[model samples]
Target: MEVLLSLVVGALVAAAIYLMLSRDLLRFLFGLILISNAANLSIFVSGRLISGAPPLIEKGQDFPVGEVANALPQALVLTAIVIGFGLFAFALVLTLRAYRSLGTLDTDEMRVAEPKDPS
Candidate 1:
């Protein structure tokens, strides 16, 4: 199961990289989302895919009675997902503003600081 998940993460990363390399800001935003998801999945898979009990201990015990699933990775991934969503939303707004002001989504064409060629 971990192997399969790893493969999926790899594929996502590859696709994300391809999209990130494009000149379009929207494509780059999509790639950023893909990469964020890939990171979350990778973190989840690394937490050891065990299915037994929740990480709660008995009243008399110091730890879980049986094989409990790891909670740290789950928590980390959840937090990361929230953060990633926030970041994506901010980036999307920035992209929209850039498009509205620059009249284009192409990074190469949005060079406001660069002087235009006379030719």
Candidate 2:
């Protein structure tokens, strides 16, 4: 299972890098999302995969009697997801505003600081 997950994460990272190198702003944003998800998945896999057990201890016992899943990675992933959503939303809004103002989504064409055809 870990091997499969590692392969999936590798694929996601590769795709994200490929998309990130594109000249389109939208593709870059998608790549950013993919990379973030890949990171979260990597973290999750690092925590190990235990089945049929929650990350909780019995009230009477100080420690769990059976194998339990790690909670830190889960919490970290949850936090990362919330933060990623907010960042993605802000980036999307910024991109939309740039598109509205510049009328282009291409990074090269959206260079307002450098005019292509000078007047």
Best-matching candidate per TM-score = 1
TM-score of every prediction relative to native: 0.96, 0.90
Global lDDT of each model? 0.97, 0.94
What does candidate 2's lDDT look like per residue over 1-119, in tens digits?
99999999999999999999999999999999999999999999999888848867878988877878788999999999999999999999999999999999999887678758865
Clashing pairs in 2: none
lDDT of 1 by residue, 5-94 (tens): 999999999999999999999999999999999999999999999997888988898878878899999999999999999999999999
User: Candidate 2: minimum summed lDDT over ten consecutive residues — where?
Assistant: 110-119
What is the Å distance of residue 86 in model 2 from its true position? 0.9
Instruction: Evaluate candidate 2 by giving its C-alpha RMSD to the native, one decimal.
Output: 2.0
Residue 55, model 1, lDDT: 88
